[model samples]
Target chain A: MQIYLPIADVSVNWLLLLAMGGGVGFISGLFGVGGGFVMTPLLIFIGIPTAIAVATQAAQIAASSMTGSIGYWRRRAVDMRLGLVLAGGGLIGTVLGVWFFNVMRRLGQLDVIIAIAYVVLFGIIGGLMLFESLRAMWLKRKGIRRPARRSGEHPWYLGLPLKMRFHQSKLYGSVIPLALLALLIAFVGAVLGIGGGFIAVPALIYLFRIPAAVVVGTSLFQILLTMVAATIMHATSNHSVDLVLALLLIVGGVMGAQFGAIAGRNLRGDAFRLLLALLILAVGIRFAGDIVLKPEETFSLVTLDN
Target chain B: MKRSALALLICLASMATATAETLVTSLSTYRVAINSNYTGASLILFGSIERDARTAPRAGPYDLVVTVRGPRRTALVREKEPLGPLWITRGQRRFVDQPVYLAVVSSRAIDDIAAAPMRERLKLGLEAEFASPLPGPNLMGEDFVEAFIRLRRQQGLFQEDPEGVVFLTQNLFRAKIDLPAIAPTGLYEVETILLSDGVPLSRQSTNFEVEKTGFEQATVVLARDHGFIYGLIAAASALVLGWLATVVFRRE
Candidate 1:
């Protein structure tokens, strides 16, 4: 069945949309990460306008993050003090990012910017994950164990001024680095329509040395609020959000995540990371090919003031 | 002198009535409503040729050409050029106040109906549309215009059907027009021209409107007019759905 989208001004196949959402959702759950990055690109590939895909996916991200974070919130794993600071930085970054988004769209360069940003980001993250996973496999084969990480050691970021206490995580550090990281993540998230949870979890655990118990919780909490701000900004400033599209995606994602989590339990650590890394690298390479390969038709049309 | 002038006026009046012909046209529906289930719209347009009582029967067969034009819009055609590793849009030409949708239907092939010069002069085909000097800031070459027309045709926004109009009788005719779902909503003007032996005789134009109704209309209005409140509502609704889904799942 085909249904017309109100704000997007297009007709899309309902079953295809549900399947696409479910597929992306399953991958996200299997990897234990937000699927906004994959969802936006897939929507565009299926003929949804790029701006509409970006804006509508923000709402979908907000919903999935809520589902993931609420459990962590109830269990008292999230660091409220630090998460609030991060959300504050995220809110400000969203405004700046939306402004930049509008400017690029008006210049008719928004599509190129989104593609290039994806290529660069996926390349770095995918390459790093592959290297880390392969090294772990080689060390295990050689019967050499990796050194245990000491959470007690404070990184050099602790020496900065304006130190703040995160009592739940048992750490005291400057808010500058945390705020800066949140700003960068939220800004990129706004531009690319990604929740940036994968990027944030690592940054929090390795760079800031936050407790592993609270890392996912804090990242989820911050991302949930940041995406809420993003959805609202996209809806008001750009008028690109389609509520119907978001609803369909959320429904499919909710179901797919359950099945994925059950399947993920059977997979081991290094292999799972390796597969995910390959998937990411493949998507990045596809985007690169789109740019470098000669297109059949170079001429395109655009209605002005869309 | 006054007697001669009166005679000349009477002679001219009688000559006008001897060869006068006019067209009459009507559409099945004047408004096309767009809703959630809307795939596309098909409407029938009926036309007839009327002649003066004193006029003699035409020696040649009558030909009809119907042209449907949608609302005017500003458009741009862009060409990509390779820069390093990426192919980016580098050249652009703008067209202002051009029709967003166009469909031409006729009794026979346009080439068979009229010669090349006449077809272009009458704007009878897609290529003829760009041959005319369109209003724009830049007067680009024919290549850009051709690309623009080709792209629009591929998108189903521009269409041509030579044998679309069928004559029910010598005077009456019917034409079916199909508007694709991708067609922009706006006013559409349909013009029917009568031609005999490649010479245009009479023409008439009628207009209709395409607009979104009910829920779709409300959604678009809210997003465009009351954007702030719409945004807040959208966010709140998503959050509620999220909370509700998790609650339902946990109970199961």
Candidate 2:
């Protein structure tokens, strides 16, 4: 099927749609990330109306994350109290993000803002991933036998109020840091239409210094709530959730995620991180290329609010 | 006593004949079966009608009608093109199966005290096929199958409602067509028509029966007996195969 967008004079192909869904699904399962970074660009490439794509991706994330987080909860790896608090902050942040999106739309500067966000975030994240992966590879070549460990703790997070102990995370941390992290990630999630797992997982592991074993499950728990809220908000507000498409992708993704989790269990910690880093770097480069290069043609569409 | 008995016997025979004359039209069963390779044949209702031609035959300044009635408040009516003396040419056939067009005529003008309202009667000229043209022959069978499903969706008809009345109105008439593939096959009236110019002239009707085919029977049995296992296997195979194909045909 080819759906024509009147303003852009572009047609979207169903085959491309299926491919994009499958590719994003696989990456999401493999990395414990929301894959929104990949999905938004893929949607644009395939000519989905921008706002609709964002909303639909949120719905997909909710389904995929629910499946994943349920499995983690069954394994008793989730910190419910912390996750809920973070989700509370996330909800507020998401509302702000949506408001920002509307403001940008009214200013007729959405495209520029999106372009800049993609470039800056991808550059930083991609560089970090590449550097870390290369360093791990070098360490392996030198026959280092030490286990990888969290290196540093920030004094700023330690000084924050509302200190809480998370038995699953095995750390005593200030709730303020966790809440702020959640808010920041939620804003990014709303803008990118992902569940914010990419940011959440890293923040849990590197900043909060949560044990690597529990980080995935905890982050997924947070993602599940955030995505569900986001999906509901988008659906009722924008009516952009394509239930049919979401069902198709999730039916496939749930089964794929189970297998991916099993595969992840078999990999070494360094090996997993290396693969994730490479994936992030690759995605970043792709985004950068799209921004810098001249597109085949320039097209515009009425903003979703219109 | 003999006169009364003779009249009763005549009424019984006439009633039987009347029941047999009603013409029926419907899309009772539809399916799109594809092979493991995603290539197979599918059937679509191109155009179908059972008309009671005895009462409303192809003659004079009259109209032919077709309708599809289904679940919910669903209704679609179409009318055949009107034939006039000027339209008939030297080699022109009696009827042409061209695109059906919707009737715009008001039913009140046709007959005052006899016929039902326009909504009650089957209007004609609605498009028979709901799907757009396939991009190519490779997509033909599946495309039609999808289109058929979509048509059912538009009418809110599916496994939920298996039967509905499709009425045809012109004058005092009754007919029906038993569509093929109605589960638990039995007798069905499909079509009916009324003939009137100055007075009631004649009426016609048709009948058909629906029965499950071997493929349909087998599918139903499989679904009832082993649906879960079959679905799991299909999902697994598709995932494994899709992954392998992507790996082999990896695009940089």
Best prediction by TM-score: 1
lDDT of 1 at B126: 80
Model 2: per-residue lDDT, tens digit, A82-191? Answer: 78878888988887776676566555455545656776776777678768777877877898855756455455865678888888777786888788889888887877
Error of 1 at A230 (Å): 0.9
Query: Model 1, A136-217: lDDT tens per residue?
Result: 9999999999998865787787779989988987778888888888998898899889999888887887788778899888
Cα miss at A269, model 2 (Å)?
3.9
Q: Residue by residue across B50-105, what tens digits does model 1's lDDT show?
A: 88776667778888888999888889888888999798888888888788899999
List the lowest-lDDT window of 10 residues for candidate 2 chain B: B86-95
Task: Score each candidate by Cα lDDT.
Answer: 0.86, 0.51
DockQ of each: 0.71, 0.01
